[model samples]
Target: MTLQLDAYMHEKKAWIDSQLPLFLQETSIPGKLKESMLYSLMAGGKRIRPILLFAALNTLGESEDKGLSTAIALEMVHTYSLIHDDLPAMDNDDLRRGKPTNHKMFGEATAILAGDGLLTFAFQIIASDPALDGDIKSRLVALLASAAGPEGMVGGQEDDLEAEEKVLTLEQLMSVHRRKTGRLVGFPLEAAAVIARATEQQTHSLTGYADHLGLAFQIGDDILDIIGNEEELGKPVGSDLNNHKNTYVSLLELEGAKKKMADHVDRAVVFLRKSGFENSLLAQIAAFILNRTF
Candidate 1:
């Protein structure tokens, strides 16, 4: 199953990698800004969010290509977030995907502008896509905006920076995790649901699935930070410890965190089953997230 999933993931990732450059090519913005955007954008990651979007659309019997524009937009938003997250003002990371972070390659100023360019360009892609209805496009724009805006990923990040050295309770930590990771993970699935005009029950189930899956994914990340190899992680390990961040592993201990992650994966699988769609691919994705090396 791992082999098959790997094959499928590689195929989807290749497709996304091939298409991402074309989107940057459409930008009329002159100068090295485009180069900066493409630098981090093309830097390799799992491409999980866009793949989830495609898989979710497929589960609903919609053509996977129907979600392509939105998928690209989500990737842009993701890349933009990473670029900013790695800034000296933020996490101050030195490596990403085994390469120098955007700020390391480009100057800090150029990196900031590159993040800004990609972020706004995401909206343009959504607005310019001819396939979606006006109403659908509007809703999608609103959803993506809110997910990536102050109340979502950015807000979570702000809290994260402030929460350093502060011992948070489980609930407080979960709140941060939900906002930081869960919301973005849920965005593409929810968008696919909306675009497919899914049933209320179907949407609810998929939302539940995404919530659990996102939590499990984050927990897995926390676990990996303690035990994962830097080579495979493409970054240094013990970052959470070095930063004094209160992670699941810190609060729950290694065994406890693993158990919690397993529980979330189980609950996610149950929700996926409740969706009543042929979602084997999504189920596999949840499993992969829980068990991934990076």
Candidate 2:
């Protein structure tokens, strides 16, 4: 079945697949490390983040080709985060997306460097995007940096680490998820609207949608951790409880967690609808986030 997305996620994935190798062409960097980065990146994901970026931009109804660089940049940033997340120092997982994780295939040091390389490369792509005005690109870079940097994903991760083996309040748990998950997820929405010159009102509305989507995605992941089959998930299940990482869904009853997730899903849909988005595919993607079994 074709997955619905902004303009179509399958199309975005296809475009990204074609663009990634071309962008990965080596210059000064050694081919080996570059290959390692591409190894995990190309291994395939839902590409949800980048597709969200596309939808966010498309909502402006501008048909410019300028959004492509930002789209790819977001994916690179996402890929780098995953590489680091799966390291021995972090999640320490042996498998990812039905394949050996970067550390397992390329060794931990190389995997770390590869992630670094991708992070730097993502900035390069953003700064060099010709389709967007330089000022807008700069703002996009800043917004993205905030999400990916210490105050965003990195900071959230720190919170996650500290909370482990310690009891946490509901607010603390949510704070961790917001920074860890919300910042990265927010990039597409912010970047898209910023590039498209959306009004402040529109940008703020999209932010709400992004926040809801981010929370919902993490909640779905928590549910999957308990109920997903190993073969199906391509990773171990119940790892959150196993790792003792506190998650909102973990602290709540199953029914309560499901209700919270439903609330988030409904809010996301409501925000998107109110924003006057005409994209049926974007609407469907929101539904998919709520409906996905995997």
Mark the 10 consecutive residues where model 1 has the least summed lDDT. Answer: 272-281
lDDT of each: 0.89, 0.82
- The residue-by-residue lDDT of candidate 1 on 197-263, one tens digit each, is 8899989978998999889989998999999989998888998899888899999999999999999
Off by over 4 Å in 1: none
Per-candidate TM vs. native? Answer: 0.97, 0.94
> Per-residue lDDT for 216-287 in model 2, tens only?
888888888888778777788888888899876678866777788889878887887776763445556667
lDDT (C-alpha) at residue 114 in model 2: 94
Residue 1 of model 1, lDDT score: 39
CA lDDT of 151 in candidate 2? 96
After superposition, the stretches of candidate 2 with alpha carbons farther than 4 Å from their true spots are: 1-7, 278-280
User: In the order shown, what is each candidate's alpha-carbon RMSD?
Assistant: 1.2, 1.9
Evaluated at residue 9, the lDDT of candidate 1 is 83
